[model samples]
Target: MKDAAFGALLAIQFLTRLPVPLACPWTPATRRWAARAYPLVGLLVGTLVAIAGSLLQGLLPPPLLALALLSLWVALTGGLHLDGLMDLADALGSNTPLERRWAIMKDAQVGSFAVLALVFHLAWKGALLWALLAAGASPWWLVPVIVLGRLGAVGLLVAVPAARGEGLAHAWQQSLTRRDLVLAAVIPLALSAWVPGGAWLALGLAAFIIVYGLAVRRAFGGINGDIVGAAIEGGELWLLLIAWSWWSFAMA
Candidate 1:
């Protein structure tokens, strides 16, 4: 139980900007333990966003509330996933050799493709979220969606080879295991069971795994932390889009 609690704390520490007052001896085993708790990190973020949205929904227009939530969302994770998305965009858009593309991803400067990707991503997410709010959809779905998004990272980290021999992915890959993957998936699966139209969540996650596997293999040769981050962003968007589409059809 103590290890589980620390593992959860370590996950929160690594995955978000949230203050976790506990510290544990950082080791490969520690990282492995924390990796299993990745979905819980998403759960915490989603819960916070849901509570905030519910509290403020009546005080502001849907668009404004969405904007506020979006801002909070980015702040919570310090744009970590978005940064990965941008890095992947820049690498893929460069159309260079694998070596050069890897260099491009490592470059700290933002590229044109990254800018466009971020703009489109934020615009789409904001618009869809606004629509959901306007439709009076329960905020409960966000928790599972967010959890599933991070669970996407867990899948890729386990299923794909690392792109580089060093860095966060390499470190994490050392600790990643089939058991960790199953542990990471459990919460999202349970949460999805309780929501209406939750099959979309499973569909979206399955689609992301297939699509991301093919695309990343072609584009980067393998997965890394950035690809994991990109996968999370894409996965979340996939879930939101699926849910939005389902809501549209039901209303029609």
Candidate 2:
């Protein structure tokens, strides 16, 4: 019980900007267990964001509300996934050898590719959120979307070979088991079912996970922390796109 409590703290610490006051010893064993709690962390993030979205629903214009929500979303996660998405874009856009691509991702400075990718990603996400909210989709849709995103990360961490023999991805890769994979997949699918027209959302997320894992394997030789991060961001966008489109069709 105590271990589970600490694992939850580790998950929150690793996944969000929230200041968790629990101090626990770090070990490979601990990290592996903490990985199991990733979906719960996504739930917390989504719930908070959904609550905020609900509160701001009619208080501001859709564009302004979306921008505010987007800012809050980034602030909550400390832009961790966004940074990963940018790093992955920079590495993929660079027509260099694998080692050099890895180095590019490690560099702190943002490149033109990263900048372009970030702009497009943020713009698309903001527009999608705005459209969905304006169309009267429930704000709680975020819960499934965010959970699916984290599950994507967990799926890759368990299934894909590590790009290199180091970093957070590699560490999780070393520790992930078959049971971990099953639990990760099952929880997200089950949670997704609670939303309207969620079966399609689940299908989209599953497809994204499969495609993303394979693409990461082909593109960068295997998955890394950046790629895992990219998977989360990419999965979220895919879910939102699919969900928004479905909602639009139903409304029409």
Worst 10 residues of 2 by lDDT: 24-33
Q: Write the per-residue lDDT of candidate 2 for residues 1-252, one digit (tens) a residue.
A: 666677778888988999998797566666766787888888889999899989988888888988888888889899998999999999889989988998999999899999999999999999999998888887888888888888778878887889789888887777778787676667777787767788898889878888888887888889888888878888998989998998999766
Candidate 2: RMSD over Cα atoms?
Answer: 1.3
How does candidate 1 fare on TM-score? 0.95
Off by over 4 Å in 1: none
Q: Write the per-residue lDDT of candidate 1 for residues 1-252, one digit (tens) a residue.
A: 666777778888877999877767677777777888899899999999999988997899989998998888889988989999999999999988999999999999999999999999999999988888787786666888888888888888888888778888888888878898988878778888777777778878988898888889887878888888889888988888888887778765
Any runs in candidate 2 off by more than 4 Å, and if so which? Answer: none
The all-Cα superposition gives candidate 1 an RMSD in Å to the true structure of 1.4
- Every candidate's lDDT: 0.85, 0.85
